[model samples]
Target chain A: MERLGSGGREGARRIGEVLTWDPLVRLTHWSVALLVLLNGAVLEDEGQPHVWVGYAVLGLVAARFLWGLVGPARARFTSFPPSLSAARLHVDEVMHGRERRHESHNPLGALMAYNLWATLLAICATGLMMESVAFFGVEWVEEAHEALFAWLMISVGLHVSGVILESFLSGRNLVRAMVGSFHKRSGGGA
Target chain B: MKLAPFALALAFAASPVIAQEVAQGDKIGTEIGAIASALSERGYEVRKTEREDGKVEVYAVREGRRFEIYVDPETGAVTRVKEKH
Candidate 1:
């Protein structure tokens, strides 16, 4: 087996450690991301293709919601339940420049992930409702859906910024780990 | 008498205008009602309908108004459905 860390150093114990995310978890994460982006950018157009894409996004969201409960370790909601106090403390750590690197999501990052999923669900529900005749042409429903899209974009931007900041702070390329399923550092903060 | 001539002219002039309005109203009402029923069969409730200049205006409530679906009166096809703001 490959040694978990470099040079058998103490700090190296957490460095160069590789913990793989299960295939289901990875698929759910990327599918949700792509669907959200598609719904926001391309589905608003007046065409049959747009409607089909909207339906596909709805299906993807439904699948991901179910997976959150039954999926593997890192993907399970139980694995990373949100805690307000923990998030606040994490925020403080960031401010004080003493935040610890996490193998998985940090408290603040967990909160963002939760919000992103919830917002996507809301958007999908509202979008589906709009297609029904009773709700069709209702101004408020349309407006609510659009508003959720705006919020989703903001949350995604914040999430990206957090990932970049963490990568620098921890001295590892977090984005690369997400793609390649391995990190240069041994610490498996995910 | 002078009054008889004026009354006759007035009735003639007003007849076409009144007939046109009624015809337009009937067409809009029938078309909108049919469309609303079709949508209702597909699970939608029509909330309001109006005949404006040359188009029929329809408003509907679906899923407790979480979203609104709009339809074109002329073709009785869906225009768009959007979430309520």
Candidate 2:
């Protein structure tokens, strides 16, 4: 135990070791994803179901945002503030074969996280606006809503790709960590 | 964690807005117009009419409730009436 203190970050976690997510964190993350699928692709644009689904998404995001403030260490915003220069440095570190495992999201992942949430809020705002009689059937509002949804889909694709790429590089099953918080450090289980 | 609220949604709207989609083509205009007039006579203020899967779909409102009136193109008979809930 004393040897680990002097050994720095290497002693903090072994390579290929899985980091876990808080249960609330996992709940909010997956719920938002599913709701996005329903509202964005499955449901009709101007209907009660779509409106309610949007509200559900906003609620989940709000829960996640609050969790970010008072949740566990890893889920906290302080653990991974969004920063492009830090992300650039992270890329450099990876390129130089000096990959450093992070307890929270990697810098680039943080940027994506923030972008996704902000985009969702924007979508929610516009969606709520559309529900008003003044904005209902307005061409610009509808177009903006559709365009934002398109952008969100593109960001979602990128977020999934980022997760896959990071998992491949780190040799850790992040989806498992997210779903079950099973951190067994590479011995077995799929 | 329950999508129960969503699943609880039930037909909720469609000719399928849960049933299919409509496309604008001049050929179906007469049938749609006839359906619209019939709906108008029934106290429904017809909003729009289109051809959806070979049926005349007339969207209308009456007493603040919106409805989807599906008319058979061949028979010119009302087949289904759905309300937005």
Least well predicted 10-residue stretch by lDDT in candidate 2 chain A: A1-10
Q: Candidate 2: misplaced stretches above 4 Å?
A: A1-16, A181-190, B1-85
TM-score of chain A of each: 0.78, 0.85
Question: Mind giving the per-residue lDDT tens digits that candidate 1 earns over A1-190?
Answer: 2343333321112234434444555566777778666756856544456566767767776676676677555566776688899899988998898988665578888898889878877887787766666556566887898899899999989999998987787666666545543435445442
lDDT, candidate 1, at A134: 54
How far residue A40's Cα lies from its native spot in candidate 1, in Å, is 2.2
Model 1 spans with C-alpha error above 4 angstroms: A1-20, A181-190, B1-85
Error of 2 at A11 (Å): 20
TM-scores across all candidates?
0.61, 0.64
Which predicted model would earn the best lDDT?
Answer: 2
Number of the top-ranking candidate, with TM-score as the measure: 2
The DockQ-derived docking category for candidate 2 is incorrect
Clashing pairs in 2: B14-B17, B14-B18, B16-B19, B16-B20
Residues A1-190 of candidate 2: C-alpha lDDT, one tens digit per residue: 1222222231122324564466678788899999999987899876799999999999999998998888776788999999999999998987887779888899989999999999999899888876654444345776788888899999999999988988888877677657653333444321
Candidate 1, B1-85: lDDT as tens digits: 9999999999998775443211122332237768666555544466655565555555655456533345556665555555544
Interface RMSD of each: 5.0, 4.2
